[model samples]
Each structure stands twice: as structure tokens, then as C-alpha cells.
Target: MSMGSCDINALKLMKKGSVPGMDMAGTVMKCSTGMWKEGDRVCGMLLGGLSSTIVDKKMLDRYGMQGSCATYCRTQCDMICKVPETMPFEEACCMPCCMMMSFQAFNLKTWPYSNKSHEPILVLGAGTSLGLMTCQLGSMMGYKIMAVCEMTEMADVMSFGAEKTFDCNDPQIVEKIMKATQNALTMAMDCSSTDSSLAIAAKCMGSSGGTICCFPLMMMSAGGKTEELMTMDDDSKMETMMEKTMGINMHNIKIVRKLPTTMFGFDAEMMGCMFKPMPDETKHAHAFLKTFSTWMAEGKMKVLPSQMAQNQGMKNLILCMEECKSGGSKMMCKRLVCAMGETGPSV
Candidate 1:
């Protein structure tokens, strides 16, 4: 299992006993459905992925799944995809969450999917797992990727398909992006979803304005003093509040906040504490997952860089999680994987 921002948020907001992981890859031990059989390799994403025990039957009834960090975890057939024989479990685990999130961002109707116009698309936090995936996907789809990442990650970001890269530490980042895009930048994906990142995306938009697709549902308070977690219904209010706080014209700029849980057809609680099934999103996600599975099999996607931890076991999983949460150089631009039980050298 690998840690992601959603897992971090879960640790902060979920109940005390809730599990922490969201992504995992392993061989199937058993299956009730004929869709998959034993010995098949698969990877999946699910809320509360660190526990085998059911903490909430209500949640289980709604999601029909459990955390995947344990030695053995169960998941619905539809929620998982077969891993390519050549792909490592560590790398396959990184896809379900990050790649799918990027897919959802691009799946928007407003996005110019069919037209390979090469329009500039700004990717804030381009160093992040999700941001890197977005850069690759955007570039593969023929968009001009303007990546904003740390100085250390600039090269890797560009290699992922970014046309230009800017240091997030640069005080003149917005100016640089504007100059690079020639003021024609109208689309952006904010993987950071912070006040600063949001403001930067808004300022980089062209005069005709554009849409900013961001992860995490956040709204700025009237005083611009704090961030408030919001629901889907509050998206309009968040857009208005962000514009007011950042002093950007809101009329043309649109803010769309999406949660990865929604991709699985579940609505997360405020701050991502819990989830409830949503019929419409569930159907959409199932269709997407089928296509995603085919893409993985055809080698149409590149997995993010990952390192399998030397000490492999459940206990070491905690240590890996701590290292990821601390955001140190060792874990930057990498996913950490830990094997449970007597997993072989294959893991």
C-alpha cells in the first residue's frame, strides 16, 4: 500500500480506529464472483484501506469494501483491475488513486478532449503523484503542459510531458507562466488545492477566463483567515469566496473541486471522515475503471516511481506512513510500499 493525500486527510479527520491506506496491489487469494479467480494479480483503491476488521457495518454496506493495507483485504470485483504481468505490485498500487483522479479531472465536459489544440494547461504541484500523472495524461492528450513544481522535480515534470516547468518557490511563478503561455492560458489543474495554489491558478488564466479543476473541497472564509471544508453544493460559494480573497475577477474563472471518493461512487464526509454511496457516480466510475483496466493492460500508462521498503510487514507500514506524512526528501516524488506477512521477493 502507498500513502496519498486522501489517506493523510483520513488520518486527520476519520474516527480514531479508522485505517489509513487507500491504494494496494496483490494477488487474489479468493473470489466469490467468476470475474476473477485465485492467483490473479490486481490493484484497487478503497476508503479505509488499512484495516481488515469492519469498524462500521453501515459504511461496509454502502461501499462493500475494506482497507487494503493488511496482509489480506477484500474488495468488490468492479473496484479492481488486473495488473499487467510485467508491472510490479509496488508500481501498480500507485495507479488506482492518483491516475483515476487525473482521469476524472480530464473527464470533465469543459475539457477539450477531442481537439488536440495543444492549449496550455497549468499543473500546480506538478511534483505530486496526482500532478505528475496529470502532466503525462495531458501531454498524451495533446495539451501543452505548464508544470509548476519544485526545482528538484522540474526535470522529471518535463519528462512526464510538461512543455515548460516553473519552480513553485519562484516568487514570480505566475508572471513566468503568463509570459510562457503568452497570456493564453485558460485551463489549470491544482493538485495542491491550497489558497496559494488556487490564487496562482486564477492569476494565470487568460482574459476570456477558464476553469480550474482542483482536488479537495475547500473554501476560504470571508476574512481570508482560514480554510473551511465544504460539500459539493458549496462549490459556487467557494468560487466566489476565493475570487474575493485573492482579488481576482470571479466572473470568468470557474472553480471545480472534486474528491477521488466520488470516482468510486461514494461521497466523503466533511474533511473525508466517512463515505456514502452515490448511484450516479458509481455507474460512471465503473465505466471508467473498465477503460482504465484496458489502458493498463495495453501499457498505455506509466506508473509513478516507487520504492519497496526494506523491512516489509504490517508494523513497518506505520513507519512508511510516518515517513510519507513528514514529506522528507527521501519520500519526495516516490511512493513507499511494504509487503505484509511472508510475501516473496516479487513484492
Candidate 2:
């Protein structure tokens, strides 16, 4: 198993008698934990994280049933998820990070905004995996979605549960979105992670202010004061960017910053501890897995469109990654699943 820097840091900390993990910088540590045996295959949230167990038949069965493996083991992973059996393997593989996170973004627990069947929600980067999930999940939750993506992708976006779709590249998009939503979006999300996209979200929803969500570390300027951990700085340039780019009065809009581990409901204390799982992690995982699995089985929620790549062997992953990174119209808003030891597209 390979884990991200955050997960690797947690493993290092675990060996030091700290909780299983807490977020930390990766380049600084020398991992000394001898947890791996000679031929053990690992499974965790990321490539090589502390949260792992041996990949067993039960897990493989779940992965096979869901047509993806992202939510195969919620008890040991951070994200919430389950995949549709009809979903292509390539797409199902992305369900945990893309679709599951999107679900959490709309959850009343994580997202403070209220949802009504009549109100519309805005989704930036609707062409992304996360964006596609947001559109599908938001639609299932009973909100009409106004998706922002490339003009070429508008039709595809609409098919994914968007009531309306707008091209982000269109100069008149803000006006178009305003007209579509009738000038008020009660809730919005920014998956694009760009200043211009986020600015548009702010402008379109200004009539009746609402909550906007984005990554936590992103709120800070590239160069700002740093301490042992995250802290709000009044002198920081974040406020300036918010005022100048977004043009919203700070009081009216609430910006919720999310971390990867947060959706599983770990509190500050649990996240900061060492050498133990959060007490509620298993229960949260079980509940989410059950609910989402049922939804997929019932056909209320459909998998985002995806197609398998030509390569199924592990060695071709680098090539697949290159294809994904070198973006194109074809790659937009789609999941590319590269299965192991398979010869052709499964879907």
C-alpha cells in the first residue's frame, strides 16, 4: 500500500507512541516503523498510510460488488463511500475520493447550510470527478444543481442531474448563472480550486448569502505566518483576497474549510491523539457504507460516467497518471480506472 505524506507521517508518529496519526509535514521524517512483512499487500486510504489491514477476500468481494474499491473498508479508511454495481471499475475506484467527499460536502453535519427541494445549489468544476459526484449526490438529496463546466461538457453535466449547466469559460457566465438561479444560491461548493471560479461562486450567490466550502490550507496565502499548526491570522492576506476577488461582505458569507479526515467526524482531540483509532470512526463508517450501498442498489443514485483505460496491469499506472495529468476534453469529468491483471475495458 502507498499512502500520502499525511498518512505516512501518522505511521511514523504511531511508532513514537503517539496516536495512529495526525497531519504533519512529510519531507522531514525518516520512517523507522517495521510494520511490513516480506510479502504483505497493503490497503489504506492513500498509497502508504498507517490506516491499513491486509487485503482479504471479504474486502475484495465488497470491491467486486461495488465495481470499485474506494469504500471497500471504511472502518480503516477516512472517506465515506460505496459504489454502484453498474459503475465501471475505473469509475468505482474513484468513488471514495470523488463521490463520497461530495456527499459529505452536502451533509447537514459537515455543511451547515440547509437544503430544500426548491432551492438550487452551485457546483464549480462540474467537469471534475468530485464535481460530477457533487452534482449526482446533490440531485439525489433533492436540490437542483447549477453546474459550471466547459461548454462542450454542458450536455454531459446536465445528464448527470444538473437542472442547468453553464460554461465557466463564458464571459457572461456570472450573469447567466444569476438568471438561472433567480439570483440566490443558498449553498455552493468550489472544486475548481481557482481564484476566478471561487470568485464567480461568490458573485452569483451574493443576493442571499450562503455557505461556501473549500480546502482549509487553501484559504491561507502561499506565503503567510506559519506555526506548529493551523491558526487564523488577522494580518494575513486571505481577507484581502476574499474582499477583492469575491466582493462579499465577510459577515454574510460563511467559509467552511475541510480536511480529508474531517468527514468521518474526528474531533480536534481525536485527530491530535496518538496510537489509537477515533472511538466513533467505525460506527460512522458502518452507517455511511450501509446507507450509500443501499442507495446504489436501489438506483436512486447513479455512478458518474467512466470508462476503463486500455491497460489493466499495475505497471501501466504511470502512463494512466500521465494521461490524467495532461488534461483534455476526453478526460474531463470522467474517472479512469486501471484494474490489475485485466486485459480490456470492463464497462
Candidate 3:
């Protein structure tokens, strides 16, 4: 209703100290005093949330951002996603980042990760932002996606089209993968960087095919993953035992980097790619926007509204992210909605 209302809405997103809306973003533009239009619809993450930081038309043109997450997103589109009209906003929000990684994974010529199709592909940490979309798109494109979760979440993991799923905590997990694929599934993608998950996926990989997984070279230990993986659990006992038990000197001849991305990708929120019925030369951001808009229009997607929480302002941002992180399935829009406040199941 007023500038104060929107500023408060922005506060609901960050919930921290008052960051001038201009200072809240990656780069800034002078408002020229008169440009601060009353009642402008703006949305942003950290940078946009704090100050008047936003990717104005000029900057959006310069960097080619798709108008997703940023410091200040006043003019690109309504900061609040339109719900009911699209697949709930939360599910739509879920796609932007996850789809980017999926696009990267799909772009690779070495799909199925293995030389053969139907080898029982694995999506490690299959419930996270990127992993879930990867599984969804991977399944859409005819690749079977077998997801992995802790023992507690295996069933939920399988529901996402993991024809086969496993509990990473199982001692006989490798045995499980082998038996499931008739020992043919050599491909795996671990979105989570945890050492135990890495080792589990790696050991399960057949000796002669790609085991696709995403982890930082930094998060990995000295001598790299195979070495780091051996030390996953209680370092002393697991490391010593793994080395002796597995004779773990295997070269990573089959391991492949899922994508070459950095933490900046997360910080910058350049973490997503939109899906298209056709893959073309349209710039990444443009293609994504087109897909997102069209999908919402066609009733192919939906949005569930996020009601504002009382009293809490931008400080709720962390709480919001935590909710998204903790709810797992609920967070990823297994037919749901989310906004500045919360997510609820799809109507």
C-alpha cells in the first residue's frame, strides 16, 4: 500500500540489520532522487533486500541475468510470483536454480554417465534444490533417475522417480546398488558434498563408467575424493578401516565433475537454468524466463501463497531458508507454494 509496506516486505526476506535497499545488491545504480517511485514492486535476496540494490534495465542488459534472485529486483517483474496462475510459486521457485544445474548435467555429451543407457543412474542428495530438478528433468528426458537419501528418507527419494533408491548409511549399500542395476549402473551424481555420500556413490560405481557427482574441490580432502572419501565417518576409525578393508587405492578413472561451478554461483544466485521444450541458442537467462512465463500461463505449473508471519520482518529470511531446508519434500514444492514467508502444499 505504501513504500513502508514494501520495505517491510523486503525486511521479511532478510530479517537482519537494516541494509539500505541500495546497498543490498551486487552492483548499484543511483536512483537520481526522483526515481524512487512510490509503491514499486521490488524483490531481492541479500543485496537487493538490504539496500536499494537491484538489477535495473541497464544492468540486466549488461550482465544478461534472467531476473531471478538478486539484491533489488524492482522492475524486472513482480517480486512476488503469481500463484494459482502458475504451478505454485514454490515449485516454480524450486526450478530456477535446480534447472540450471540440470541443464549443465544434460548438456554433457556423456549422459547416462555410463556408456550404456538404463544403467540405473543415481542422483545423490537427491532431495536438494538442484538434485530434485535434475531428477525431474532427467526423468522427463527419458533417463531413469535413482535418488539416494539417508536411510530415513529413501522412500521419499524413490518417489521422485528413482526406480531404485538406497540409504547411504547402509554398510551393504554398494551391494544394494550392484544388485539393483544387475551391476550395470555405473553412473551416479552426488549433489551433496558430504564425504560419506561421496564414498558410497564412488564405491557403487562400476570400474569402467562415469559416476557423475557434484562436490567442491575444496570440500574434498588432500589427495582428493578417493582419499577424502575413505575418511568419511569418524576419521580415525573409518579411514584406517576403509584403507585396509577396501584396499582403497583405486584411481578415479571413471569419476566425472558434474558441473564447473563456484560458491560465487550461490552467492550471486546465478545458480539456475530454466527448462525448454527445445534447446536453442537463446541466451540462458532469456530461455529460462520464456519457459517460466509460458509454463505458468499454460497451467503447466502452479503457485501456493506464502502468508506473512506476524512481527517478524526480514529476520525471517533465515527462518524461511531453514524451513525450506528442513522440510525437504515440502520445501522443494512436491506440489506446493512459497514466498516471502512460508510454503504450503498445493491445493
Most accurate candidate by lDDT? 1
How large an RMSD does model 2 have? 10.4
TM-scores for all candidates? 0.84, 0.63, 0.53
Better of 1 and 2 by lDDT: 1
| Candidate 3 positional error at 135, Å | 1.9
Q: Model 1: per-residue lDDT, tens digit, 268-315?
A: 555323434456556656666776778788988878877766657787
lDDT of each: 0.70, 0.49, 0.41
Candidates, ranked, TM-score: 1, 2, 3
Please list the residue runs of candidate 1 whose C-alpha ends up more than 4 Å from where it truly belongs after superposition: 49-59, 109-113, 217-226, 229-233, 272-281, 328-332, 344-347
In candidate 1, list every pair of residues with a backbone clash.
49-67, 49-68
* Candidate with best TM-score: 1
Model 2 stretches astray by more than 4 angstroms: 1-91, 110-117, 216-240, 244-248, 265-286, 328-332, 341-347
How far does residue 24 in candidate 3 sit from its true spot (Å)?
Answer: 15
Q: Over the full model, what C-alpha lDDT does candidate 1 score relative to the true structure?
A: 0.70
Please state every model's RMSD to the true fold in angstroms: 4.3, 10.4, 10.7
